[model samples]
Target: MVEHQDVSAPARLRVGIDVGGTFTDAVAIDAATLQLVGQAKTPTSHDHPDGVAHGIVTALHQLLDQVGRSARDVVFLAHGTTQATNALLEGDVAPVGLIGIGTGASAVFTKRLAGLRTIEIAPGKHLPVEYAHLRDPHDAAAIGGVLDRFDAAGIRSVVVSEPFSVDVAEGEDLVADAARSRGFLVTAGHEISSLYGLSKRTRTAVLNAVILPRMFATADLVADSIARAGITAPLMVMRCDGGVMSLDEMRRRPLLTVLSGPAAGVAGALMQEKVTDGVFLETGGTSTDISVIRNGRVAVQYTEFGGSSTFLSALDVRAVGVGGGSMVRADLGARSVVGVGPRSAHIAGLPYACFASADDLTGARLSTVAPVPGDPSDYLVLDGPGGRFALTLTCAANALGLVGEQDYARADQEVAALALTPVAEALGLSVRDAAQRVLATGTEPVLDVVRALIKDYRLPEDQVVLVGGGGGAAAVTPFAGHVGELEWRIADHAEVISPIGVALALIREQVERVIPGATDEQILGVRREAEQAVIAQGADPHEVSVDVTVDPQSHTVRAVASGATELRTQDRSSRLSDDDLHRLAARSLRVPPEEAQVLASTAAHRVYGARRRRPWWRLGGGPEHPVRVLDLDGVVRFASPDARVEQGTVGDGTAMLPRAVADLTSYGDGGSRAPALRLLVGPRISDLSGVLDESSLIALARSELEGRDRREDLVAVLERRA
Candidate 1:
């Protein structure tokens, strides 16, 4: 139980709930003081993991009681969970069938093989019925075949996809209707991606379909739990994009919540620590994820999901298979110690309690050196707060060949030192360097691993903020001190961090228009395009704002379309058009064009200004004048006969014209044009010299003077020839 105090005259309270696979953590924060008052961690019940809410409410009630405050004082509730990620990853999710129209030629079908079932509608077929136009009209047969397949697999829901379906969803509607007739819950693709890209759009739709059931289940449980706890305050879920949204909306777009848990830690970490411009390393059971935070925001990189190279800028988090609890063995043939991971052992096999039996060879070595004789077989290892299972040092040591009196004869420190060298070498580090890096960091085994690797690589272990959720966290602490300024922090509950990350992430909705060429005008059009979209999304037209960012050298422009929402239904947009090229030309070369073609379009959106939009114009000139021209007058006689001309008669003058220039006398009866070029008055040689650079003048002098000498020499040579 935790205690809290209400110190404000008018009090405000907030609760942050992070739901994970292993445990659910609840932190009650005083909105007025921004101080944490209540915190709880409860073992997660996977079967009805939904039951974890009871523990959360119990903890909150305990805090409220201690503070002598009613539950009504709680004004804001923020939540993060991992239900959606697990549903997708463990294949313990809804059975969704995908109806991909306009995607018959797309690779989404191939990609779908890994997650859900997808059927591409026959191309050239219209809505209501693709077979409507078929001469044979075998629509019934086609429908029956599709339904039969769905029935065999027991699919509960269906997601539909079609090209440009947001605007022309009729085809997708018909497909959904046909699937619905077969008793499948249908989600239209047009309802998902009103944007672009048959493949990416379809993939987004498919992922939504696969995760919707889980999202709906979690949303319902959470809402019910909140109401049951006598809390009327709204419950908000964190999106993958790091924004909050109403649970209702999150259910519809659950894919956005895939990174909710990690995002929350990223958010919580950013809030608690002064970690700027560094990477956040989150180690868990299955993998170690690394993400960078720059300027206090998670920096996202655009890369392909999985193996397919679809472009998107997402938080740069890389999950390496190496984590604590990985298997260690000696490759006798190679005469090296190798730790192999990227896969995890069943938690039941190596419970943390039997440190020796935990299947960690390192743990076994430590136990042997300590010579602590506890009942090895009866060790129960329980994880989370419950501490459930059994483990033994012999299990870990025997597996790694550390046994009997011989191994036990070594001191714990000596054994650790002996193992450290090879481990460092395995990780490509020297013993001392590994120790330094490990000591610099805070987590036990992780820092030890970091140290080993650092030593192996002969690198300095820089102190960093470490975030991990695992049994190995304690063991990794000693070595973490080696790095300078390393602040070691672990998640309140570590095991399910990634799953929680998935829940709190935002949904990315992008819209693109294919406007040809880049130009200043087209750039304006792109912004208008984004604004119109925000308005269409039910935003107050006046509240919408369009901002543009440009990289002049690369001739790139990013336009951001955003709007404020009380409920957080923020829409973000990006447009990549060549229209901005005109601006670049004007800014870079002082020459701007009026119109342009769009080379590309890319945009991402959340509730606020999270996405980018820009335009680049490739072609088109100004409306007032498509071309410009100037006329040059004669050098010798200016409205005068050659005999009356003087060296000082002309004057220096220049003019701007709108179009191609022709000789003033050639176009019509000899008349003056609106604009003409004028020259300076001076001796012929002096006037010519003024306009030319030094090199030109030198060449002119050489040519004239040398030619005279050459002429005289030529004459002499001619006389000699004669």
Candidate 2:
């Protein structure tokens, strides 16, 4: 419960709800401080006639009551759900009608689109889609026949796909209009992706189309409930790419919400911890989701659906089946621990042995049995005086003293050690050794994923950190980090991280176009489109920042815009002094205050540089000067191993762009390429790393400063490339 000093006035709050498979969690936070004020949990009402929406409302009401607040005080509202993902996993999706257009080679391409007809969503079940090919999509007569066939097949959602539609979408647009006119929810391939792959684009649209009806109904129900609860803010939904999109945007691109469950937890870690370059591990009762944030941005890539590739971009999260409630799998006959689980005590309706009193375990006998049918019968459970208690990974961590009292998963260490005595006797070892063996076995898989992510992303071993969140973080992440020899910390309010993430997430939208050799005007056009897209979704226009990327090899011009609908930075508490900013940066750098110096300054940011300490045993080149960019709000907005920061006005920065790029560009066998560049113009950290060509980079740099005053402060940050 939130203990407010005064509840007379309406407290400004942001409410977030995350609908998980087993529970729906809601949290309310001080929108300005970003502090957790209240939270509530309710069982996921899957069996209810109203479905998960009922659970959301129930949790929201509970949270409001707990905080002594009302829904009318909520300045922002957002939610993250697993409904779309579960639908695909369970084959509970609406049937879709696919209309393929074009002739000759494109006609053959249309036949390939029919492959979705047998898309197996599960072991024995497949997505139900009916495909129709039309040589001329604009032929109103032909479109009517397709609709009739679709209606006969009981399909209301339609997808229009034509070859090279990314280049020319007029035909696909016309067909989509015709379908919508007939009361069908329609999706066009080109709208989902700007890439030229016909098959991938159409497949992505089909994936989005399959879940349209269910998601629409659920979104509408939740929206109406929120409105009735007195929340006037535009409702947002968490996306799979670690951002929030308005409910309206989700209606158009519901596929983006498929795997957002893990993204929500990572987003919480990112915002709350001010994580720059690190991997976030969110450990749940049954599994852990691990993802990366490089250069202050979450790593994202095209995700696969039902074992097929799609153009949907999502956070690259990897899951490991080792968590707090994971049942221990042992080889009792061999007197050795084998592995941890994908099955958990929670699923088996058993309580953790550590949570029980020590007296309850008197004369307890260890028995190994499969928690679920067909699972290996090596899972250890203790039959005690209280009841049957599962010796889980959480028990192991507590027994080994790896879980502290301050941890969310904390339990009585002595009691945990006593509960594991049965296992110790079986192995002829001390209880701590048995527990150590179990934790090591459980964290092995998680360590593998961490190592693989580090290698794949080329993260600097010295700088990479591991931050953990979720209810079971203490059970897995700390020991995994110890084994992997990485720095780690648990997030505050880890159990409710998902809801906090939803509350703090910014409104985001991305737009892309395939234009061979896109000019300056074309690049800006895409940038403005992204900016407008988020504004349309209720992001404040003045607070919006669009980062544009013009890729020459792919000829893809991409823009990502992010903004806050209601500026949460309120009161005089947000801004800090220059000395405070430097102190914050030093703590973030893990260096002494004296060693951290202000390298440069802009209106809203201070660039602090510190000398990298090298190992005394090994001789190397001169010490590196790494830099961290700290905003007045005391958030580390960016960090790099080494960077060149030069502060000047917009005109000065524009004039110095070429020289800076030339000075920092690296030369190697691969050829010369400019260093990663970012300009701090006011509060916006304009990322120019995506512009590959030198001239184009300059043009983009100038474009970022286009509307700004020539004398406005600008800080150019060029990350030195070796």
Q: List the candidates' TM-scores in order.
A: 0.51, 0.94
lDDT of 1 by residue, 208-311 (tens): 66667667776787788889888886576765544455666676677666655556656554433324334455655445555555423464443343334222
In candidate 2, how many Å is residue 591 off? 6.6
Give the range where candidate 1 is weakest over 10 consecutive residues by summed lDDT: 713-722
Compared with the true structure, model 1 gives a TM-score of 0.51
Each candidate: how many clashes? 101, 0
Clash pairs, model 2 backbone? none
Error of 2 at 22 (Å): 1.7
Q: Candidate 1 at residue 487, lDDT?
A: 48
On lDDT, the candidate that comes out on top is: 2
